[model samples]
Target: MRIGELSRQTGTSTRSLRYYEQRGLITAHRDHNGYRRYDHDVIHVVKNLRRLLGAGLSIDDIHQFGTCVRALDLDATPCASALEVYEQRLRTLDTKIDTLNHLRANLAEHTKDLRQRLRAK
Candidate 1:
């Protein structure tokens, strides 16, 4: 199908599709008129790409998926490399969450102190 059709079907913008092609995440053939031609299976690919992006995986991290990128929808587990990337990203997120929680606790303590002082005044 054409770029516009793919965008409509996938609910993704044509710009994103082109970016996917430019980023080596997906491919398209150019017709004689210079219009992009995508295969039917591109729908699945686009969905998988969106899923990965939603999962907080960067485009570079998605490249580590290898063939698993195409198999994201399969019932089978992803390849080990993809699993490794997922694990790493999880650790990173956990660390950030922990840091945020610590900051929030400090902020809350400061607010409580200010409120108590204000009440005394």
Candidate 2:
């Protein structure tokens, strides 16, 4: 199908599809008229890409394991690189949570001290 059809079918913008092509996430062939043409199976690939993006995976992270995902066989066999990406993202989130918790505790203590000072005055 053409780019417009793919975009409509995937509910993705043509610009995003172009960006995906530039990022090596998707491939398209140029017709004689210079229109971008994609295979019908690319719809599945785009859906998977959207799912990964919604999960907070960056383009680079997706690219790392996109080949396995684009294979469309993940339902039967999960990719090892995909597992690694998930693990990395989880660790990053854990670190951010820890930092935020520490900040919250510090802020609570400061607020408590300021309240006591105000009461004394």
- Scored by lDDT, the top model is 2
Off by over 4 Å in 1: none
* Per-residue lDDT over 1-121 for candidate 2, one digit per residue giving the tens place of the 0 to 100 score: 9999999999999999999999888899999999999999999899888888989999989988947868665666679999999999999999999999999999999999999999999
Clashes of each: 0, 0
lDDT of 1 by residue, 1-121 (tens): 9999999999899999999999998999999999999999889889888988987999999988877778747447647898799899999999999999999999999999999999999
Lowest-lDDT window of 10 residues in candidate 2?
66-75
TM-score for all predictions?
Answer: 0.92, 0.91
Worst 10 residues of 1 by lDDT: 70-79
What lDDT does model 1 reach?
0.90
